[model samples]
Target: MGEVAKIKKFLAEARYHHQEATSVDMVNVMKQYKGLVSNLEPYVFNDGTCRKLTNLSGTIPVRYKGNTYNIPVRLWLMDTHPYNSPICYVAPTADMCIKVSKFVDHNGKVYLPYLHEWDASKANLLGLVQVMITVFGEQPPVYTKSKAPYPTQQAMPTASPPYPVYPGAATPYPAMPSQAMPQPGGFPPYPSMASETPYPPAYPPASSGYPPPQQTPYPPMQPSPMASGYPPQAGVGAGGGTITEEHIRASLLSAVEDKLRRRLREQFSQGTAELETLRRTNLELVQGKSKLEGLVGRLDKDCAELDKAIATLEEKEAELEKGLGKLSSEEPIDIDEAVTTTAPLYRQLLNAFAEESAIEDVIYYLGEALRRGRIDLDAFLKQVRALSRKQFMLRALMNRCRQKAGLAG
Candidate 1:
């Protein structure tokens, strides 16, 4: 290769990138954002802030979780478009209510970590959508099909020069030429040997231009080990060579199956754990209820016994009241005779009741007179003599009553 060849190659590469940047009719806007444009009808670059008025669309089939979900997107370029991230939205279907989620709101406002940490100098529309597919995967969109499962989940986190990797591009984001089509899923299927090497088999014509220059003589081509070997080479051609189409397809299938299995296992484990916990909690609740019932039963028994005791006491009170009523209805007792009769009874009771308090009962009536200081010496002597006579009377009364009882018996 000569200096002229290097310059030509550089020019060709530059031309290729230029065409990619302006694939849409809105070259000014597309050049700035490098978006995949959806041109509506007559091709024209939209000049104003009103993005809808422009004949452009950025629809793409986003692949996620092994499902190809078609995300029809529209870009609303801002007045300060390149400096700031554009307002993007995924159009809703007429039949389905779009589920509001962290990444995409019901009204279609996206809240992505990339957007939160946006950098205008290096970000582009293609990169934005690529990241959208990833954020949406965390909580996937409902029911439309995506182009394919993610090219590589690991590819999503990279943000610098975050353009979609076209067939030849090194970066993970979508920066491929428009020839890139949405197959069943994924940006581009793994390349074959021919695609793995970006240049064609034949060399280009020598460059005629000057300012930029490059020249490196090409070496003769050799047969790929893949085709040369007895069996096809391990990958593409050699063991460590670029990924082959077959390998990509096999990997996708295996990944889908593995994801499904893992999901099922997780659901089963979670349900089983919940059931065990519920059973334990239920056991505790039942035991607590049983203990409360026992305590209530004991209280009921005690209440019933108390009620019976009250009823028995009530009966005794009623009987005593009835006896008193009958006594009141009968002739009034001669208090004097009653006193005379009860005098010996009191003495017998006092003698029989031998507790220490019996002596205290003696001074009961005399206490008032002593407190009043009403007894002079003469009065006290007279009262003493009268008390002596009463004692003699009590002795006669008891003897007479005993004789009568003996005769009657």
Candidate 2:
């Protein structure tokens, strides 16, 4: 088996032994060494590492002891086997060497150490080697064999037979062997050698020197019946034992006249029918046009009536507006006259009272004037100014009126 195949087989066994471990442990291991393993981490854990090594995967560079080491760690873990034990290695330098100082004692025997310095550059390389060994067994043998250079046998040339021909026919031949043979169920086969002419006996030589005869032109042909001495017929004569031309012409003229008469009758009948149809159509059209005219006239009359009604309404509206304006103007004049007629009597009664009674009478008259609708605002204001001017005159008038009436002032 191939080295890669054996390594894969070892890894499968190792993975089976480690199958009891949780997927998290595998993932943690891969992630911790991701700098050494790179993108293989997810596949190693999630895909169950056994399958990963079968594909002969790439390496990730891990640094240790101030040097970068390419560690061959199989992604797969293998079960312990007696014959082909799995093995992995970390190369200290480009050339792989084991450093004895970095070895760690496990169970009293020295095994390679785990890198614990936490210094990414100075750690154990043997740890990576041990991990690989735990996964894939030791490498397999390499085989070296070379292949032969060129092909041994060469192709040989062959000639084709002539095509077979039918008994009475000629055979046309191809010039070269590379030309395709005529297929069966196509044309007949070519001629055999017994029927074929020899190359020397085939065609005549060009130097025979005898010329061929020239061809003559053909004569024009004459009409047979006239050349056989048959005379031409005259008009109205029964020549050639047939009917006379005049009778044939008369029959033809009669047929033509009959056809013409029938055509004329048909044309007259069709004209009469067309006239009747046209009359009916004209009547229908006239009726329809009359109906349409009546509808149009009705529409026009209705539109005119609507227009008249609109005009009448507009005139009435204008008259009503004018009447309203007249009423509005006359109303204020009548109100003014009514106020002028009633207001003077209240003022006279207020002036005739004594001083204290006059104040009360003036207030009463002012209220009565307001209530009776006898005081316009402008006139009431003028009356208040006039009363102020006549305050002493009004007192004298009150005294006189009290004396005349014999009442205490």
Estimated TM-score per prediction?
0.29, 0.23
lDDT per residue, candidate 2, 303-388, as tens digits? Answer: 99999999999999999999999988874556434543234544454445435465556756976896789887777777766665
Worst 10 residues of 1 by lDDT: 203-212
Tell me the whole-model lDDT of each prediction, alpha carbons only. 0.46, 0.38
Model 1, 1-409: lDDT tens digits are 7433433343343332333233322344444333334332221233633222222344444444343444545654433434566566666554333334445554565556676566767776557766876665544433333334233233323323322322533432222122322232322233222212322111111110111111211111223233333443333432544334444444445545655654565455445645654665588789999999999999999999999999999999999999999999999899645643346655553333333233234334455576688666566556656665665565565565556545331
In model 2, which range of ten residues has the least summed lDDT?
200-209
CA lDDT, candidate 1, residue 409: 14
| Model 2 residue-pair collision total | 24
For model 2, give the RMSD to the true fold: 45.2
